[model samples]
Target: MAAAQGIYTWDSRSSSYSEIYARVRSWWELLPDGSNPLFVLVREFEATGVTAGSFAVLAEQFSRRSGTAQAVRCDLELAKVQEYPAPWDGLHVCTVTVQVVDESNNSRNAYAAPVTVMINCPPAVTAPTGRCAMVGFYATAERIVY
Candidate 1:
C-alpha cells in the first residue's frame, strides 16, 4: 500500500515495506475512528522528501482513488512541532513528529516509529521560487534512537 500510494518505490531488501504493511493493517482493523494509514503514509513520504514520477502519485494518496479511500482521515493532533536553531546562523530547524498509533487502549500499540520531519527555514518570499528543504527524516523504528 505504501508503494501504491507513492509513499515510496519499493525496495526488495528494505524493512520499511513490512513495517508499513503492518501499520496499514492495524489502521484498517481500527476502522471507524482510526486515522487513515494511506494519508499518513503520504505525509511520511513528503516528510522524507520523496521523489516520484509526478504530483499525481502523491495526489492519489489523498484523493482520486476508490470510494473507500475517501474514508481515510488524518489526525492533526498526532503531529508535534518544535523549533530549534539550525547549524547555520540564519536558518532555523523546524521538526515535526508524525506519530502513528493504533486505536486500542493498550500503550504497546501507541507509537509505531513516528515519521520525523526536519525542515530548514526560512522559505523564499517569492512564489515559484520559495522552497524549504527537509534536512532529516527517520521513516521507521530502526532509525529511532532508543
Candidate 2:
C-alpha cells in the first residue's frame, strides 16, 4: 500500500497530506538497510478545531502528545535490502506513511521530503553499532564522522 493509504479527505474543509519519516532531516540516514534503526515522523493538522485518528496499526510502539499542536513518534523496523558492514557499500532504507492532516484543503499538492542519512558503514555489524538518530525532527541529516 502507498504511504498515506488510509487517510481520507471529507470533501468539506481545510487540507491534509502524507510525509515520509526519513524525509525529516533529524531522522534520515545516508544509507538504507536493516542494521540501523529508523524513525517515522508524522505531522497532523486541521483547523484550530478538527482532529481525527484511527491510524494504521503498522505503527507500533508510538508516543502521542498534544498541546498547541499534535505530534507522534512512529516506530519503524528497517529491512535488510542492502549489504551490511562495508563502508559506502551497504545502504539501508525504510519507508512509512506520514498522514498529514489537511484542514487547509490541499491534498494533491502533498509531497515527500526523503532524508538522506549518511552513515559510517563498517565491514560487519561490528561490536559497536553505528549511532542511531535521536527522536524529534532534525533540521538536517548531516553526516558527522568521529
* Candidate RMSDs in order: 15.5, 14.2
The per-candidate count of clashes, in order, stands at 0, 24
The worst-scoring run of ten residues by lDDT in candidate 2 lies at: 137-146
Assess candidate 1 and give its TM-score to the true structure. Answer: 0.26
For each candidate in turn, the TM-score is 0.26, 0.21
lDDT of 1 by residue, 1-146 (tens): 13213222222223243554453333222212332335554444444333344333433433111111111222232232222223343232222233332221222223322333333334422112354443333455444211
Worst 10 residues of 1 by lDDT: 63-72
For candidate 1, give the lDDT of residue 106.
24
For residues 1-146, could you state the per-residue lDDT of candidate 2 as single tens digits?
A: 12112222232212221232222323333234544444322332222122334322212223221122122222123322233332433232332323334322222333332222232333334222654332222212231111
Candidate 2: which stretches are off by over 4 Å?
1-91, 105-130, 134-146
